[model samples]
Target: MKAKERRNNIKNLLINSSNPIKGQELAEKLGVTRQVIVKDIALLRAEGKKIIATPEGYLVTKNQENLITKIIAVSHNVEDIQDELETVIKFGGIVKDVVVEHSVYGEIKAMIMIKSLYDVHNFMKKINKGKGEPLLVLTGGIHLHTICADNDEIMDNILSELKNKKYLIY
Candidate 1:
């Protein structure tokens, strides 16, 4: 894999993982050298990924310094996905993750990490072109998004906008 794609994969793995992952484990998982993993870690850190080296291994911080997060319930049809994501991005909120409660499985979550309109468009294209179905379909368009911002003001603005757009639930 290319360095950029590999770094993105590394970020996705770290973001989705609930536990720390050792460098060697990452290396083996990505079919690269341990040294490459180490360099990728450094590059990711330089790019403000909030990756910290723990005694166990490397763990991506869910709550970074000065970052405020809010989970909001929303219900919208699949066709409105881009509009919903664009709304969040326009308000300066980072789309951190999506969560849905399943009747049989309980809470199911996926890391989105969408920070810009480009990312949102890419996500929409991937979903539209591929067979990958959105988790919201399993929950009748009702779901939750973990939005992050540098402060509460931005978050409040996002919530208000979503509410005005009829995306926010309650």
Candidate 2:
């Protein structure tokens, strides 16, 4: 395929992807190296594509009407993280990202990619196995999570549950 055609194809792939598309996959489809695909994505972004780079891959944001995002402050012991995530999902919210204030790095954000209890459990397990500390613990059990939902009612319910569980800091 010509370079222009390849770039166009990559754009189409990214636009249709609900989640991040791996560079390797793109490269394989275009008979090029992953680096080339990365460059192509960069060029596409430079041309005004709303693509978000994530740890897992690159994803194009969905153009939906009435998309709302809010950050909720939450706190919990290591053991309660799962419960917190479950509550968020139960209330129809996606725990989009986690933010922590680092002493030297300032505020650090990580994409959690959690929308279900299964994701929560696996994330906790990985952290446990790695013996890594939660960012909230570093900040004295205070952390913020960016969440997305259809409306404010979901957030209200999540806040209520977090409060009941003593996960919401005063």
Top-lDDT structure, candidate number = 1
For model 2, what is the error of residue 119's alpha carbon versus the real structure, in angstroms, after optimal superposition? Answer: 3.7
* Segments in model 1 whose C-alpha atoms lie over 4 Å from true places: 1-63
Candidate maximizing TM-score? 2
lDDT of 1 at 38: 97
How good is model 2 by TM-score?
Answer: 0.78
Q: Tens-digit lDDT track for model 2 on 3-115?
A: 88999998889888766677898898889999998888888889988766654577776753474687888877777788888988888878878898889889988777677
**lDDT values for all models:** 0.87, 0.79
TM-score against native, each model: 0.66, 0.78
Deviation of model 2 at 35, angstroms: 2.8
Candidate 2 has its poorest 10 consecutive residues by lDDT at 59-68
Worst 10 residues of 1 by lDDT: 54-63
